[model samples]
Target: MGKLGDMANKAKEMAKGHPEQADKGVEGAERMVDERTGDKYDAQTDKAADAARRSYGSNSTTDR
Candidate 1:
């Protein structure tokens, strides 16, 4: 596999072991993007974070 694929697989494996932290990481990224865009991309950031949480098999938290 290529480097990107390898990295993705590694992330998936890590998330499986630490789903909560994985979800937090996604939430942090979403917040960073939203803040950087001055809330202009809040909707898209939320959608992406939700998708990432599902992919990581993690429960969503009330952090918004």
Candidate 2:
């Protein structure tokens, strides 16, 4: 749980100043999950990305 919190914080920071980096982070995280779970959690990646964006308060449609 602590690690998850830390990741959330990092994602928020990335989304705040560098959305592209946040996107990359999401992709990387997804890839890691796929590698670990044998692609069993493909749908969860989008949820993770959305959560990260929301954590940063940058989930808006407009570019920030």
Candidate 3:
């Protein structure tokens, strides 16, 4: 697999073992993005949050 695929697999394994940590990481990433973009990309942030939650096998905190 390529580098991106390898990274994706590693993240999946991490989420499977520690969902809460993954969720926190996702939240942190979202915050960083928001700060960098001045909250102009709310949709993208929400989408990322949902993807994070899904990766960890948890329901998305952000309502679609």
Candidate 4:
């Protein structure tokens, strides 16, 4: 795996123990992107962010 892949795996492991924080991080990132893009991709970004949040053991209200 490449360095990015390695970092991803490490993050997943850390998320296992800090799911809430991970979810917050994902949401924060999504919000930042949406703001930067003027909400153009808000729907898609929310979907992906929800998935990422769930992967870390957190359940997001936006996940449906």
1-64, model 2: which lDDT tens digit per residue? 6999999677577688887666667667767887899878766765765676666666543221
TM-score, ranked from best to worst: 1, 4, 3, 2
lDDT of 4 at 47: 82
- Note the Cα lDDT for every prediction shown: 0.84, 0.68, 0.82, 0.83
Which candidate, 2 or 4, has the higher TM-score?
4
> Candidate 4 regions off by >4 Å?
none
Q: Which of candidates 1 and 2 reaches a greater TM-score?
A: 1
Report RMSD for candidate 3.
2.3
Record all residue pairs in model 2 with backbone atoms less than 3 Å apart, i.e. clashing: none
Winner on TM-score (2 vs 3): 3
* Winner on lDDT (2 vs 4): 4
Position 57, candidate 4: lDDT: 74
Candidate 2 TM-score versus the reference: 0.55
TM-score of 3: 0.81
- Prediction RMSDs, each to the true structure: 1.4, 5.5, 2.3, 2.1
Q: Which candidate number has the best TM-score? A: 1
Q: In terms of TM-score, which candidate is stronger, 3 or 4?
A: 4
